[model samples]
Target: GKAVFDATRPDEVRQFFDGLEPFDHLVLAASGGKGLGPFATLDLADIGSGVDEKIRPQLSCLQAALPTLNRSGSVTFISAVSAQLAAPGVAGIGAINGMLLTVAPILAVELKPLRVNVVAPGVIDTPWWDF
Candidate 1:
């Protein structure tokens, strides 16, 4: 089932998933908070947008989808390798991605029986790149 959800409002997300029958799996691959440039000249104000975009939405989606997910089903989150392999110019984005690394284990344990995992892809071929 394809549906657009407002991740900022978790209640709405929960309501959306509540309407759907239990599913075998749920995959969350949305990401935001881009273009932060290097940390030296970074604006501290972007923190809210950064956190709101990635961390909040991801959690909201999980909380909403968990109840409707099959006990033996899996929840796969699409994160980036920058979470652990933070290179230059990625300090900001890396922090956001790192949050997922810390949370997956806790969620796996807390949400027992349901598998929780992450898929951190490296630089991949995409249509957006003209090269």
Candidate 2:
């Protein structure tokens, strides 16, 4: 079964996870690329929005899920290949994605016995891009 909640809202994340029984796995697909343009003109607020909209939500979900997450289960975070590329017009996006890529391994070790992994996949046209 699946339950939907707004991960961006810490209150929602806490409530959702607090109500869960033991779960096998979690796949965090939270994503937002608010600033995807040349660094020179990109609004700084967009960068902050990326952290608020994407990074914070995902991190909050995981933190809230910790108690309910099974030790033997895994957590997969979906980042983007922009983090691994030097493509023009992606500085902000890359920085945000890179944060997740950077933390996955550390979390794996920190959350030992419970797997933590990240996938930085190439662009996939999904409804999230409809914005």
Candidate 3:
């Protein structure tokens, strides 16, 4: 998947995962999950390049695999605590996390028989912050 996606364009996403089968477990994460922002003003190209490019294809792939997913399969999406907590320059992170958190439950409910869950992590000691 790319870095950003146009949620409205399902076809683009679907085409990417046309032949792949579902797995027993799926985990999703994003590099942009961590960052400070006032929500960068982005154009279509930026959206396509930064977000849609990354997430859309992955989601399309997942949606394509949903029907064939294992009966007991589990899908987990990694979000951030920013979904619940607010901070300065975290608007974009919070929005994205919140969207994933909200979508997780819906997916779980709608994709019954297939478990869907989200792991929202808070600040942790990671190599990215070591610098």
The C-alpha lDDT values of all candidates are: 0.77, 0.89, 0.62
Clashes of 2: 0
Residues forming the 10-long window of minimal summed lDDT in candidate 1: 122-131
lDDT of 2 by residue, 1-131 (tens): 67788888999899999999999899999977587889999887887888888888888899999999999999998888888898899888888888899999999999999999899988788887788
- lDDT of model 3 at position 13: 46
Worst 10 residues of 2 by lDDT: 122-131
- Which has the greatest lDDT? 2
lDDT of 3 at 66: 75
Candidate RMSDs in Å, in order, are 2.7, 1.1, 5.8
**Each candidate's clash count:** 0, 0, 14
| Candidate 3 structure quality by residue, lDDT tens digits, 4-38 | 44443677445544545655986765343234455
Global CA lDDT computed for model 3: 0.62
Which tens-of-lDDT digit does each residue in 11-127 have in candidate 1? 887889899888898888766746246889867566566578777888888888777789899988877777777578767767777788888989999998899998777777764
Best-to-worst ranking by TM-score: 2, 1, 3
Best by TM-score: 2
Q: Would you estimate the TM-scores of all the predictions?
A: 0.85, 0.95, 0.64
